[model samples]
Target: MRSGKSKRVSGTGSGSRKGSGRGRRPGKTAGTSHHAAYNAGVAEGTSLNQSGGGRLSGHEAKLQMNERWTRRCMAKGASAGTAGKRIQESRAFAAGFAAALGQPDSAWQPVQLTRSAAAVVFAGPDANPASIRQLLRLPLEEIIVVQEGASEAQFAELKALPEIKILNPGEPLGADVWRAVGARVTRADIVLFADAAQLIEAEKLAQLLGAVQAGADVALVSYASRLGPFREWDDLMRVRAFVNWTLGRKELGVSSIGLLPHVWARSAMDAVGVKMLAVPPLAHVTAIQQRLRVQACPIAKRTANESGKSYQGLPPQASRKLTNESLQTVFGDHIEALRAAMKLKGARLAMPDNSRCRSAAGGAE
Candidate 1:
């Protein structure tokens, strides 16, 4: 069922025409005083333009430009929303089909392995490794921490954990981290690309593994933001996420955003290529997620605060830009590619209910 939100109107319409001289012939008898006054007003400064026949004034032109921009933004937003809805519907159909096929929910069994899953933690210079160590109590087979501008001492401190590997990039952190996570790690069934400050739940690792066993390629974990009460940043993030999830599912035939603390299969990670992350993390992840049938698994609440500190030494503006780029990469032309691939493969694409996915799959308690 479609959500009750009103369908947004596309912003496309003709601009207002300037006053016409043909309407007022030179020899025409001006009938009424009101008409004369109107003409006078047009001749005076009230009207946009008088000398150029039907040209608009600078202010009028500016107004038109603003209107056009406004319309474009609205149209873009509407288009995104429509795409998202389509994905949701497709998922629903797929889920119903699966149910009808009598596909047992617990048919797939989890891999019985004694080794712990490897988690790749991408941390900033200022992240408190202590907090991360305390939060994530998973029996990690290997913990690879990628830090930028961190001292050897700090790296050593983080590597105090058993079976931990610390890599400090003297220069800017690049695809090396992604490559390590994608290629280097051998025993890793699940890879958790996370920040140091992000507090992952104790059971998050197990839950992620469960989802993977259930046939999910990528699984995203949900957490609450513990930053300020509510801000524009939060709203924008929500909108971005909603749009990403909707469009990714519908147009790209993949699941995109929901929450952080993401977990994914090692095989799928290798397939998408590590270089993809360096280009656009979100988009790359989305492409891989769709390609691999990414799923979501609810976990602990995520708290983001000023104390959490920044990563990659990137300014706030740069971070935002990176995120936007990632979104564009995932949903841009990639969606069309995914659709084409789906058609070629004769894959049955379904749109599941976003509400149900959000609730049951992952996000919040």
Candidate 2:
């Protein structure tokens, strides 16, 4: 989802400038030889495919579809043993061809460019002034803070800051609406959305901005720990990640583990309507549907001690339930698309190796 626009110049009256975890660090350098690099890239792609890092390639995808069909055949009374043999044969053929051909180098390469970025923080009641001040030090052109139903007293502190734009939206526009409003007013080449208390270090911002410059439509921050209290990633997050890669929207195989302090290219945001809720599942779904290049970069995870009052506002239990419900509401209509795309990976998306092993054992007569 890389765009071909010149870097946006910084707006007037900025005080100064500045320079710019966890999930498996992106694969090391792909070595010198084109063949070797290509193979390495393919291996990374395969790893990503299995791990749900991105989408499966065509040959692999066909094989996945065939496997699903074979499962259906077994479900309808075909011999399980024969169906299993066909699955193995297809995989063998796929392995031989994939090893020889490898994936395109462009698939692994990160889009690179130099551009200015803007940070849009959704300032809730528990917004952290210190975190906001820290974020301001990054080499961004502007900062826009969205607060729903903010009073004059609430506006006083944020408005006092130079180069900051405060959007009250007058009425409470709920989570996604106000964020969308704030993004509409953001005028930088790259737009980042983080919570008021989310701690996004300067180093992380540089990596994210680099991805956007490199032509990624959206650059996400993937933390080392599980994003929420859920035992697994939310169902919609998993489905979106799979669909994005399976449909070939993004090449750099970053996991859609979580979206926080995420950065987006203005064009990409506009391409897929910007919905800036406290949580933006729909924003990601639209990006995938539009085939935008979405990459996930890893950052050191934030700790409970670090989160403080922000976590307290929406207590973990309520937060978890609401998050699940919101994502469900956002994605309910798109379940069929999710189901079809998920078949490319199947239960692999839901089960870890151990669970698969246990289930396999339990199935034995």
Candidate 3:
């Protein structure tokens, strides 16, 4: 019973397994700062080392290699942990990956320009200083924090930073509308939008930015894990799935621009118009119809700490009363999106439109 071998578990899309029951909110489980810096450095070093051997950009190429390696190890029955350890060892062959890991963040300062990006975060009721600190660490040229009835001391840290720009509108801008506001303010090639109140991580945000850099027009944090089994999903989940499915993107599952921290390419925003960003569902649908590259990027090391929290798993207990207004707003937006899609692709959405002889009933043709 003592074989000196490891068992690997390949995860092309981690936390998406049908009955796995690990529906954690995405973004919180990002590796710590030191780990993040090291991984980023390794990714960058690998990209540099490749020197354009294949069609894939360094990021995509490295991602593919990792998936392949994981799959190979799993085929031979290696544990996920073992595969991970081995992968860390194998990355040495990626040329400078080993050296990059050893180097400090200061050592790689010269090449940080490539990560230039921007963010629009709404500090809702859940705002906190820690989350704001995380946002500042990204390579964003500016972080536009929209304060929703927050006090002066509420976002002191945001104002303290030279890169932070606080926007205080006399009247409230609806939930996702701030995305449009931020998009209008920034000239960055890549932009991120999120509710600053969320307990998200800087490294995860950076990953979304990196995806745009690697050529995805819209990079969504995979939220499939948050939506338990398909059979037990609620109307919200159904709507999300239907939206992606109706647009010939069933593979995206329940990922939507309406939820989670998502990033977009400036070109994609330009194509759809910044105003479209106000209605996230509509913007997402329009982008897909226009053939823009959208991806539901799988989050690595996702944390399930929010297990008892509402909406990420089993139905909220009786104590957690559903907010009717929020529900109506989201559903209304979904209707508007579907209506817009119907206008472009007929009411049936990608399904065949039968050519009927209406003239048979009337006296035309």
For all candidates, what are the clash counts? Answer: 15, 11, 6
For candidate 2, give the lDDT. 0.48
Best model number under lDDT? 3
TM-score, cand. 1: 0.44
CA RMSD of all predictions: 27.3, 19.5, 14.4
Best by TM-score: 3
Model 2 root mean square deviation, Cα atoms:
19.5
Give the candidates in order of lDDT, highest first: 3, 2, 1
List the candidate 1 regions with Cα displacement exceeding 4 Å: 1-116, 175-187, 223-239, 242-259, 279-291, 300-365
Candidate 1, 219-242: lDDT as tens digits:
654322322333534433444344
- Candidate 3: stretches off by over 4 Å: 1-115, 302-322, 353-365
Name model 2 segments beyond 4 Å from true.
1-113, 149-153, 224-258, 275-279, 300-365
Worst 10 residues of 2 by lDDT: 14-23
Error of 2 at 213 (Å): 1.7
**TM-score, one value per model:** 0.44, 0.50, 0.63
**In candidate 2, what are the lDDT values of residues 199-219, reduced to their tens digit?**
444434545665676677887
